[model samples]
Target chain A: MKRLRVDRWTGQLLLARPGACPASTPRTALRPAAASRCAAVRTRSTRAMPEIPTDEDYADGTDHTRFPPLEKLPPRATSLPSPPPERALQSAKLAALHARLSLPEKLPLQTLARALVDNSADENPLFNNTNLAFVGQSLIHYHVAEWLMCRYPRLPMEILYAAMKGYAGPAALHHVARSWGLEHAAAPGGEVDPGLLQFSLHKPGNAIVTLGYKRAEAEGLQKYKWRHGISSRVVFDDDFGQVVETDKATQLRRADTEYGNEYTRSLAEKAYANCARAVVGAIYAHAGREPAKAFIRSHILSRTLDLSALFSFKKPTRELALLCAREDFEFPIARLLSETGRLSRTPVFVVGIFSGKDKLGEAAGPSLEVARNKAAMNALKSWYLYSPGEHVRVPSDMLAEDAQPWTPAYIDMGEIIGR
Target chain B: MEAVVTRPALSCCRRAASSAPSSTRLLLNSSLPSGTRQKSTAARTRRALNIPPHPSFLHPNKTPESVASRPTSDEIIFNPPSSAPSVFHTPFKFLPKTDPRRMANLTSNLFASSTTIQYNYSPSSAASPSAETTTTPSPESFPSIEGPPVLKPRHHLTPQDIEQMRRLREQDPVTNSVQNLARQFQCSKLFVLMCCQAPKEHQQKIKEQEEKVKARWGPRRRAAREERHRRMEMLFNGQL
Candidate 1:
């Protein structure tokens, strides 16, 4: 058996023979990524002058790429002897450090290999033996999962996560939900159900309905009502000390106020409309496409009627006030009547302020535009409330023929009656 | 000397509504000329230019012929009725007469008697005491009647009565409009202002003055008030 001499001094890979002339052998054979190890191996031992082969001895014609044969290998030579005390100690130390740095079986690539194995599983593979893992296991994965669900509902969740993040990575679903206004509904059996999403806990009663998820309850799981629309109300009262500037202040003081004052009531109405729009946007996230018809009828128009009874004011006062401020009132009234055609009910009417016995002004029709036209006409004519001589005709061609007739009624105009 | 009452100030309340763009405006009625209907080769050539039709105005429903088909309802309920006289000249007596016969003819716990003392007056109730004097006419120095007087029953007031009350309230500087003042006193403005030239803290003063008047006048007034209460209880229970 060939006894290999381990170079303990410099921690080199050495093959040395002891107690006799060393047999000629090539020593510079080891290919380490350093210079000193190769040099040490080459000069370590020499007993071979017999058939020492030089570098040019065998230029292999067969395959120049392959290693040369072993018989024509170089001779090894011995140089300085090992230092007595410190030499062996240093060698042992170096050997230990090298071993610690590069363990024979230490595999750094195992983590990467394991991840890849879990990622690519075979179709219908066995559970334990398979090396596949679902790609989307994190919140980031869910975000991509939801985004894909938005545009393409049937896309695989793992592929979505992988494609969205490029690799299986982190994502935020809440942010995505807010932007698209769609969310997964909570369903039984641990599966997600696609639904028009809403984040609010309060079930708002409105025309639009949001998709919601909730745990099964005694009330039943689907019993969770979702709100997809918004509405606001404003009542005028002296409790606010007559003049409120901001919409926020108006809402804060609705309880103790009277709805008799048109100006404040009008202001409150506008604020409510704005608030309703915001609420609709918040819940369903699509105010543009949706006509908002249901939102108007249910929250604004219906609630205003109920409020009329509560405020002791006539219902028309509140409803017409809202209509007068509607968006489409700017168009000519003739055009409005022409399109919507004749109205069955009088638009909303405001009593004239300048007539001898101020007559009630009548604005009628279902759409908010017609209502405003009638109201504005009454205001312009000062109806029965103002003296005809002093009445101010508002400048607008929007008033239609049906809105022309102003009937006077006997009302005590007080001392300023005809002025 | 009726004081002029100021109009109620406009409230600073915001107008409530989410706005939308105005829809296309159209004329109430206009028909296209018959000649324009013919699609001649030249007209068809012009039509290829794709210019919007000379914006022919039509009603929103696209039918300009029937503008009056839809009659909209006005919400204000208190406008003066048509065919009524232009000037309001009703007498104060037109105000709901609170006579005993009218009161007894009704059916509610409360009735507003024309008398000075108003007791549980539910206008719907129809029980009232009939007070009549059968003896010879009393002298100029007639003795004051004891207890609440059985006044006429005033059921409901007319608009003219309301105006009169408002006018009467306007005469007093310290008083607000009749509508506002009536809300506070829970009564007509005509009578309340009649008692005071200058609006003072009179309720307290009257309570104090009444103490002296009752002491001097003895139990006659107290007995009258008690009778008023009794009549109220009877009226409330449907007991005549």
Candidate 2:
């Protein structure tokens, strides 16, 4: 068997497009990208020339096109940043994945292959998942946001953002992709199978999957931990209601983080998330909107997240009172419902918070004060976590061809502000 | 915990159940949801719920007192141990109608463990205590007479009482502290704090004094405090 050419022919492929005679031109100016491995591969290829067929095989008839035959470039492709787009047709794993996900037939294998390549693996936006991920991210966030807003109308902005992150953020998407059971390449290369996810942790990925306004003082959001109001977050933050990280901050983070560190794990998660988004984006691009929405509902929104567990109130009683006052309800009063082991080592008190005749919430705790506080918190949570029926109509449902006449959803007037 | 004491009763149920008509046994074994009920916890919980034990559960030589005590009525009991819930119990989630357990779960456990605590100070139980003269006249006060233990918050404070409490607290916070005001007004300290506040200067002075004390903390102590604060923040963020 003829040993693979490896990365020795990188500069050769870069210089010689299809129909160009590589034998005539001298290997004078090699790209800096191939500078390190170029010399070693050159010597190996020269020695292995006798056994392996020379460029004459390709020049004889095949690959009259501009680029090399993408279908048969695993040997030479290793030298390039990304595998040629045509290589996607020959990837068994890619086809298996397509079948497994039941992706729309219109979404070609080439785009699915391209989705596997992260920006860190291939910088060219044309080949990488950046743009597709961007499209997919927007679509995902929109669907998730509309569903959340309609379902639980009274969630505070902070909790709303948390729920969004829990549903569509990188970590969540990473798990979603993992559930699909796609294998990833050890390292990105043109020689690797198109089906495998390709990413680099050592090199910082520069892909921004969604568009958001990055404020001039974005660094302040990280360094000083300044409180940016919800209004500002709505205007200036990313889709998940997070301050957009400046490129400099990302670079600094990458520099300090060691190999196999949490940052690296995060980078891997983000890449996986991007890949999932790109698949959706490809669907939207190829099939249509309905299929894409169906994909999101099945993959992303179907995942369980306990929204009530997201609340963290500093002054629950005060907040509950404020919420009652704003809603024109009677002030909440906490009454002890029961006490057990009161004079023993561990006392348990159950408290219920009542507003007029209605008992809003109840909780049991180790002490009367703790129980009262917990009950108050529970009351505030119930008020904030109000949900229309699980099947409440979302705005996206209106986008369908046979949707009903739109019904206005009732969203609360933001969270109750406290002293 | 390792005793596994319910087996004997279970064996008796099986023997009695097997001898009962085949139709009744088949009804008892009808079907559970198609899951291999995992682990000992589920098994133990299931065993604990074998209510209205089979007739053969009683030993041949068992005394009359045991049979006499147990109610023969067929009413279902709401008793649940304060531990892992019985395997028959389904949680309050929006389960679809198709779930095999949905029908049973919907019909039961609505008030599971609601009245677990049955002990409260009754009037008869408190007859020995006689501290009525030491208590205030307000009905909201922890009654020295110790009538029935009341869970309801007493709406005994009139507008004048609230106004007077506020006046006293405002005039001299040192004299009318939360504990002192609660004692004088015959209410809870929490109620006293809610009714009024100490002057702004006193609050400021207290805050400043706290700051001074915090400033004097050693570096190790400061770091521990900072770490504690970070953990609390993480707890709120759901990262803890």
lDDT value, candidate 2, whole model: 0.68
Against the true structure, candidate 1 reaches a TM-score of 0.16
DockQ of 2: 0.06
Q: In model 2, how well does chain A match by TM-score?
A: 0.81
Candidate 2 clashing pairs, residues 3+ apart or interchain: none
Weakest 10 consecutive residues, lDDT, candidate 1 chain A? A187-196
- All candidates: CA RMSD in angstroms? 37.0, 16.2
What are the runs in model 2 whose C-alpha is more than 4 Å off? A1-51, A56-75, A248-257, B1-240
lDDT of 2 by residue, B35-66 (tens): 22333686677777666543323211234544
User: DockQ of each candidate's interface versus the true one?
Assistant: 0.01, 0.06
For all predictions in the order shown, the interface RMSD in Å is 22.9, 9.7
- Looking at candidate 1, what TM-score does chain B attain? 0.19
